[model samples]
Target: MRLNESTIVSASPKLIWDYIADPGNALHYMSGVTRWEVVSERRSGLGARYRMLIQVGSAEVGGLIEVVEFSPERDMAWSSVTGVDQRGRWRLRGVGGSRTRVEFRFAYGVAGAGITGYISELVAAPSLRRHLRRSLQLLKRQVEHERLRRDAAARQATPEATTA
Candidate 1:
């Protein structure tokens, strides 16, 4: 099954890309993801691999996934290397000042499970869509909050120039 969702975040594309492209920040925004750990020495960007598991029904499903495409602050795509057959991509575009349009796409299917896999996909489609939407919402909240925090810190760091 294929699922796509998008949201606008009040943060620059670079900020959104930096946060989403880094697997270390997945737990902060990815809903239903129970495990997201780097399995390869290379941490972020192209060729990076991670062992991930997402809650599905009463079980967790996933495997090692490798980054198949990386376009700096624009796009990041990955596919499963082992375990469940899946592909995912994140696309970010700057929309006006300090606004980013972020889209997440995911596709998954069983390789040899045949009918059972189809049935599972049918059953899990709704939940998966819901999770994807929730994840985006969480991501938007996180990025905006971080932006606010950073802006506040910058303001605090800059002392007012006293008039002579």
Candidate 2:
């Protein structure tokens, strides 16, 4: 199964990239995810590994995932090797003049284990889709909120520095 979502953020690509590419920010943006912690020497670039947990219907599942691709302010991709069979990618596109469009894609194979995985994916697809959509919405909100805070701080500073 695969899922995709795109959201516009009122900030520069560089600023958004800094947060999205950080390993510590996964749970901050992912709605289904409950925990994410870096497990490799590399932090957020290629080959970095992280242990993550996703709340799937009352059960949490996930494990060590390695970053396969990382391009500063552009793209980030990861694949799981030791746990669930899944791959995910995040693409950042500049919308020109201080705006960014972030596109997220997730692809995962359902294990044919006793028909449960199949059944679960069937029943859970809608919920998972909703989670993904809300996750992107939350990400947009967080980024835009940060942008507003920065702008407010700048506006306040402008007045003080100009007077001095």
Candidate 3:
């Protein structure tokens, strides 16, 4: 099954990319994700691998996933290396200024369950969709909040020029 969701974030594409592309921040924004930790020595960017798990109904499903594609500040894609069969991608488009359109897509199915896998996919569709949407919403909040905090700090750091 495939699921797609998108949201506009009040932050630059680079900011959003930096936050989402980092495995350390996954648990902060990814809804239902119970485990998100780098399994490889290399972390963040292409070739990075992570062990992940997301709640599906009463159980958690996921596996070791590797960054298959990485375009700085633009896109990141991953595919399952073990466990459940899955592919996921994040696409970021800068909509001028500090606004970014963030899109997420995921496709997955059980490897050997055949008909049972199909049935499970069908049963999990609604919950998956809901999780994806909520994830994006949480991401938006996180990025925007961070942006505001950074802007405020920058303003406070600058001293007012005294009129001569």
Candidate 4:
């Protein structure tokens, strides 16, 4: 099955990229994700590997996933190495004025399981879609909050603020 979701976040693409590129922040913003640990030497770029798991229905499903595509603040894609067959991508497009249209695409299926796999994919779609939507919302909130904090700090350090 394949799923795509998008959201417009009130933050720069660089900020969103910085937050999502860090594996350590997955559990903080990603809904249904319980584990996202760095399992390789590199942490935040192409070839980086992570042990990840997401709660789906009654079970946690995921495994070692490696970053197959990394385009800095633009896009990142990953493919499963072991566990559920899946490919996921994050696409960031600047929509002007410090805003970004963030897109998340995920495709997964159980190979060789025939009709059972098809049924399972259909069954899991709603929950996975919900998780994706909620995850984007959380990410937007977190990144926007960080943006606000940085803006406030910059304002505080300005010459005008200091003189006033």
Candidate 5:
């Protein structure tokens, strides 16, 4: 099954990309993700690997995944190297001043489980979609908050603030 979701974040693509690229930040913004651990020495670029898991029904599903594509502040994609078959991508585009269009795409299925796999994928679609939507909302909240914090910090550091 394939799922795609997008949201507009009131922050630059760079800010959102920085947050999503860091594996350490995943759990904070990614709903249903119970575990996201860097399994390779490299952390945020192409060829980096992570052991990840997400809650599905009563089970945690996922495995070792490797970063297959990384394009700085634009796109990052990963494919499962072990466990269930899955691929995911994060795409970012600057929409306007300090705003970004962020998209999350995911596809997964059991390769050999036949009819059972098809039915399971169908059954899991709704839950997965919900997770994706919620994750984007959380991400929007986080990056926008960070942007505000950074802007506030910048304002405070100016000479005007000290004089006032």
Candidate 6:
């Protein structure tokens, strides 16, 4: 099965891309993902590999993926060669000033195990979809919150900006 979702983040595409593109920052946003860490020596850009655990039903299932494509501030795509039998990608685009459109897409198998896999996908996909939405929302909230905090600190340190 295939699933896709997107949201506009209230930040520059550069900032948002910095976060989403970093393999080490995986745990910061992904909802179903319990943990993710780089497995290879290379941590960023193409060819980076990571071992990830994603909660599926009552058990956590496979999520080890490798960076297949990486374009700074624009797009990144990864596919699991060993685990979970899936491929996923993150796409980013500038939506005017200070806003970025982010998209997440994945295709996973519903083959084998017959009705069991079908039923699991039926029940799990909805919850997984919600997790994706919330993940994006949380990313937006984190980036915006950090921006606000920085602005507040800057204004406090230099009151001239506010008064000017």
Give per-residue CA lDDT, model 1, range 9-59, as digits (tens): 999998888898878899889999999999888998889999999998988
Error (Å) of candidate 3 at residue 92 is: 0.2
Model 5, 1-164: lDDT tens digits are: 99999999999988998899989899999999999999898987999999999999989999999999999989999999999999999999998988999999999998999999999999999999999999999999999999999988998889697578
RMSD vs true structure, all candidates: 2.1, 2.4, 2.0, 1.4, 1.5, 2.0
Measured against the true structure, the TM-scores of the candidates, in listed sequence, are 0.94, 0.88, 0.94, 0.96, 0.96, 0.88
Q: Record all residue pairs in model 3 with backbone atoms less than 3 Å apart, i.e. clashing.
A: none
From the highest TM-score down, the ranking of the candidates is: 4, 5, 3, 1, 2, 6
Worst 10-residue lDDT window for candidate 4 reads: 155-164
lDDT of 6 at 46: 95
Candidate 6 least-lDDT 10 residues: 106-115
Please identify model 2 stretches exceeding 4 Å from their true place: 111-117, 160-164
Q: For candidate 6, lDDT tens digit of each residue in 1-164?
A: 77899988888877888788776667888888887888889988899988877887887876678899999998898888676677778888988978889898877754466888777777778877887788888888987777788779989999987999
Q: Candidate 5: TM-score?
A: 0.96
After superposition, candidate 3 runs with Cα above 4 Å error = 161-164
Choose 1 or 4, whichever is better by lDDT.
Answer: 4
Task: Provide the global lDDT of candidate 3 against the true structure.
Answer: 0.92
Using lDDT as the yardstick, the better of models 2 and 6 is: 2
Cα-based lDDT for every prediction: 0.92, 0.83, 0.92, 0.95, 0.95, 0.81
- Clashing pairs in model 1, backbone N/Cα/C closer than 3 A: none
Residue-level lDDT of model 3, residues 79-107, one tens digit each, is 99998999999999999887999999999
What does the lDDT come to for candidate 6? 0.81
